[model samples]
Target: MKAAHAAWRGLEPVHGMIYFVPEARRRYAELGLSGRAGYFTSRSAAFGRASVELVVSTFYNFNPDLVRRALDGAWDVTTPQHVLDARYAAADEALRRAGLHELPALDEVVALTRRAAESACEHAQGRALFAAHAALPWPQEPVLRLWHAQTLLREFRGDGHVACLLSEGVGGLEALILHAATGEVPVDFLKASRAWPEVEWADAQQRLRERGLLDGDSLSADGVALRRHIEDRTDRLALPAYAALGDAGCERLAELASAFGRAVVRAGLLKPG
Candidate 1:
């Protein structure tokens, strides 16, 4: 797991696997990496190839194996369900790879989507977000995926460190939350994640105050109330659409999404879907 350990330098809950797990004592000897022994149960998708995969959504693609492990983690078992859960997740992953499933096992946060939309409404006083791209050159992830995750342990982290930031934070993070009661500044993923000297937090705070977006150093009462309303409705219905997936099936979704995202990117969609 040296490579895996290196990958998730700043990320959390990193799981990895060695091709063979002949018990906890000799795995490191086989892999030839000297570290604490992170033995693989059948649950270690991070340990096995195809056992692990990417988890994806309309806006993001994640390691599916990661999701599988996450969900499985929700239920603690006294009877050792690791292998059974792994099998189930793998089956689900396989089915998804075949393009049969439409949604993720993870529930959708419609409130986030709606809030993003509302951010547009609040900031759409002059023009659209930007000139719509006539065509964007989409890029597919190489078939040989970067089977790695890392976390960056930096004290004063800043933009300009894409690999470190993503390794530590969300794969795609917009600095100016489209929904937050901040300034009208719209920092795209690139800008939010990459850093902009001009877009400091202090300036954003001032704009939020002057724009009547807040009152007495706080968001307007209406903004607070409306945000909660959206959250409540979305929470009530936000359950995993693919709760029935087996391990293989969930892996399938990750594999399919990886391929599809690449395809969509290559097709040069106006934007990353």
Candidate 2:
């Protein structure tokens, strides 16, 4: 379980860096998106069958109206499927163009990723978000299939994470605020793309303060502990996907994936925070 979780952790930085990569940003800009709003909406539509409302409710955790606005902007630029296709293509292309494929053991890494993702999806059958995503037709290409599989694994874990958050009485904006307080993600990034109204954001902040989770812009010690608990539970919830791999398999997968992650970092695609 530890190995599987660590393997996922290893691949995560590489997969997630697609959003931060300049090559991806340039591709979105070509489609008329001005900033991160365009990137979020267009790229998120990779789950083409899921509604904008579902996207907002699950992954985004942003204002629905603002999400709608972003989707509208996205449609003005391209169709939903087109947006998804372009995003998949762009991210994949960025990796290849950056010469990541040339790295030693990358083929083995992709194969292991495919294996892990396939196993995770099989276990994810009844999961709401994963089920929704799984209902989509498979992509023809290898790269696209890897991307879709990775997406399913992520959403499956994310749905479980949301369940954990709900059990802890944490809602969407509160979750984001807590994440910010933990200093994991940048505050500006969260505040900018989430599109919460000033009143709503302030209200969330105030509520966190009342709960002893916030001290101005930072997390109180209790807040940090709470956030850590949330993350620990989230990791636990995600372990089942990796548990199928066993310890050695997971360790090998993590070792291979780390190479790709390093390639991503070396490409200057991810910005330091």
TM-score of each: 0.21, 0.84
Q: What does candidate 2's lDDT look like per residue over 1-273, in tens digits?
A: 566667777666566766777766666677777655555665465555446676677664677777666665455566657666667777788677556757777657666766666676666643676766666676665555555656666777787888888888889889898888777888888887677888898999999999998999799998888877887887787776676667777799877877766776777767732
The lDDT, on a scale of 0 to 1, for candidate 1 is 0.28
Which candidate achieves the best lDDT against the true structure?
2
Worst 10 residues of 2 by lDDT: 41-50
Global lDDT of model 2:
0.71
TM-score, prediction 2: 0.84
RMSD of 2: 2.9
Give each prediction's root-mean-square deviation over alpha carbons.
Answer: 20.3, 2.9
List pairs with backbone clashes in candidate 2.
none
